[model samples]
Target: MAIQSSKTVSACLQWVIIPTGSHICMAEFFKTSVTWVVDFHYEGRPRRWFKAFGPHDDPFQQMTDTLKDLYGDRAKLASVRKATDEEELQYLRGEEPKNSYCPTGR
Candidate 1:
């Protein structure tokens, strides 16, 4: 279930409290699930990462599809491409822009 209006994820964080937490919830917070494009792949198996979400908020069905569709649409893609860095920060709280770039600062 989504936290909805509440910004705090403490309750959800408690779900990971090993006495601690569910394996799935742990996976989501860590961003190590296969759903994250650059996320770690466990052993040789790619996890069904979106399975951590409840059916109601289906991240895969909702966010991923929208992301893919926008990626395929030139107009939509152009709009986001013009976003300023500050605006981009707010836009990607969870949303993915197809040409995601991660700076390594290396």
Candidate 2:
């Protein structure tokens, strides 16, 4: 009876269906209530940043070189992992640094 009544009352809601891909995977599902947001984060730092040599001494490579030149071995030519946000904040705030030769924190 409820199903019959529901069929009698037509809903004016609009729906869109796009079947472009071969298999329909629900991996990116987040729209049951209408707010769309997608931000991807890596569990570890990108492997490209850890390389000893990068893209022919370009900006990233040059920056790494500059740090090594300025701070030597303490400047992290090869880091075990990405610095956490809090650690980076401490560096910016002069709360702590691995090396004392980096001039005044201000």
Candidate 3:
């Protein structure tokens, strides 16, 4: 038989959350069998990076927990919301859209 090297398998989710009145927080969630990695961005730049080694089976839960621990009362968890299509486009373009939620910033 031929020898083969094992490759790591992972899943990723990209989303933006607006926690109550706070500025938009962009997040990317990456999950593998042994760990979870999250990257957070603000105004198209890296803000925070987090990684957790897991015995836990749920990646979503890990993401939620990480967010909760990072931004507490200043951000309301129940108000966490997804990014709009325009917001995603703006982020990818590294510039603010014409009708952006926060109109002042570029």
Q: Pick the candidate with the highest lDDT.
A: 3
Local accuracy of candidate 3 as per-residue lDDT tens digits, 46-98: 33222334344555565567566866533322322234566545554656433
Q: List the residue pairs that clash in candidate 1.
A: 16-20, 17-20, 18-21
Which scores better on TM-score, 1 or 3?
3
For candidate 2, lDDT tens digit of each residue in 48-84? Answer: 1221222222444555566567656554433333345
lDDT of each: 0.35, 0.35, 0.40
The alpha-carbon lDDT assigned to residue 74 of candidate 3 equals 36
Ranking by lDDT: 3, 2, 1
Q: Would you estimate the TM-scores of all the predictions?
A: 0.19, 0.25, 0.27
Runs of candidate 1 exceeding 4 Å displacement:
1-55, 73-100, 104-106
User: What does candidate 1's lDDT look like per residue over 1-106, in tens digits?
Assistant: 3323444556655442223347667766646422222211223322211123332354434444554564443212111113345544543454433322332210
Residue 67 in candidate 1 has what lDDT? 43
